[model samples]
Target: MSTVDQDYQLPGGGANITALPKISLHDHLDGGLRPQTIIELADDIGFALPASEANALGTWFAEKSDSGSLVEYLKTFDLTTAVMQTEAGLTRVAREFVQDLAADGVIYGEIRWAPEQHLARGLTLDQTVEAVQAGLDAGVDDVQSAGKTIRVGQLVSAMRHADRGLEIAELAVRHRDAGVVGFDIAGAEAGFPAGKLREAFDYLAKNFFPATVHAGEADGLESIRGALFDGRALRLGHGVRIAEDLVLESEDGDNSYVSLGPVAQWVKDREIALELSPQSNLQTGAIAQWGNDLIDHPFDILYQLGFTVTVNTDNRLMSNTSLSKELFLLSEAFGYDLTDFEVFQLNAASAAFLSLEEREDLADQITEGFGRA
Candidate 1:
């Protein structure tokens, strides 16, 4: 319904990517706040920032995240979370986040954030969850009032390096009936394995709750193995490194052959969704073993191999990107057309943590929108 869809379009005069319905999974709430919002919240809390102006602060975040290390990329969240300690800051950011997603034509989204990181201002875990839920509800109402339809859910995350996995898991379960849909474990994937959170995973499994683990991004195949076996992850966050399990054998004229290791085969066979973020993967050096550019990304290989691949903007503000922009860049890189884009959206819709009927409705909405475009 937004008329501001002229910015992103397919090559060769095809449909505009921004106007197409989309689904966003693996988007982080703390990583998507506006730079101007950060400045205002920082001012209210008397917190010092690296840059004074909004544009400069935005550049600062992008620059910091481009350091080619996941640890360095994660340091930018400290500033965003600092201002988000209070109720007002959290609500405003969540509201604007959903509004931005709707304007970009996202019909459904799941926002993941670690509640334990926002407890600096004397707020309990449940209170933080309530504040964010209130904001998400308000944002949905705002979108509906503007003649657009959008739905959002929360994926509560536990910081892997911290010792509160069970606590965070319990917090998520407490808010499951409200708006929380699933659970996730994020932060520093190499040294902190999914096995570290076995108790948390066990509890979620016992309660029949779904989970998605951050693996194969900062780490390698063993991390992914743990994510699948120990964490029992239904979806993988930035699972680009699963490509490591692929072995290139030989290539004849116009023909190349490759073999998948057991882990990669299992993931592909089981239809586990891979939440791949192109720009963020390049920035964090998650695909550095392949090459430095998007063309070198294994997304194409995985897609061709029948893997369940879904595109995302892992940290939109940090990567200076949106879901539309990410899809546009992938199109430019891999020569994707409207059909390819539709497949990506369909994959995300199928992987969403919703009832089968809800997913079918979302698929119908997506098909109708794409058909009209």
Candidate 2:
């Protein structure tokens, strides 16, 4: 079966996780292209690939991304982005991305991509955004026609290492009414702090736009602080490193006392959602300090502390996973049941870049769907 078609049941076999309504906030458009689509697009563009066959190419991406280094995991994007230079390439990949999300039972998703990366083939920034919106629209139509419902919005990202943050921020804001919902800064989070994009963030803030910054993954608490203070992000993309700020004070018979540092406290108190992608975090070594396994992730700790934690499949192709698979894996590792999964979905619904009414509608859908399941 295709990755999205695979059925995933809750641990001990209660509900089919694939059929559960879900929300995805941190999925990458460039990173989720189907391998077969990449092969055809590369062939059309005369771009050479490491492996010509579809299955082999998919395996190559998975293996390469399994490396512990975030830098190494990010290198897999070079191939995926190569064929996505043209309007047709972008549209097709986006359509299929939405289709996959729908098949995996995602009722809402916020797809993020860097427009500057697709300019190599001479398409203007506006053209790229328009092309992607077309694809997203087509995908939504396809899902509706198939008797399934899905909604998605674009989250335009500025490359942190590339000093064009202000330009990209303008691009996103210009298309806010079209399909863009929010702004973000991605790519190399360690050395390139959010402070580097102060101008862009300032403009976004002035325009009253929303943003979700990628931090606390490849870096630590300071990176998250920069994302909050400098970027003024509404949500944190993989803010798993905030666990570093949790100080374990003392342990009793069955209780352990912990203190939250300034950053963690602010995140919890403000209800900033942490977009935690379990498999992606493990592959990128984002949770190495905690341990190498899903059980070792700080997700449970953060969730128990009342921090808004949402589950995501950051890169479906590179991680060879789906939203259902991610939830299933987490359930297996932590013995979570349907109730826990529902809470995660509700957290994502609340944190989506939508109006309060729209978010409430989404929550209603989740509650209704989970009730049926």
Quick one: best TM-score, which candidate? 2
Give the residue spans of candidate 2 off by over 4 A: 1-3
The lDDT of model 2 is 0.95
Cα RMSD, model 1: 1.8
TM-score quality measure for candidate 1: 0.98
TM-score of model number 2? 0.99
User: What are the Cα lDDT values of the candidates?
Assistant: 0.93, 0.95
- For candidate 2, the 10 contiguous residues with the lowest summed lDDT are 1-10
lDDT of 2 at 227: 97
Model 1 local distance difference test score: 0.93
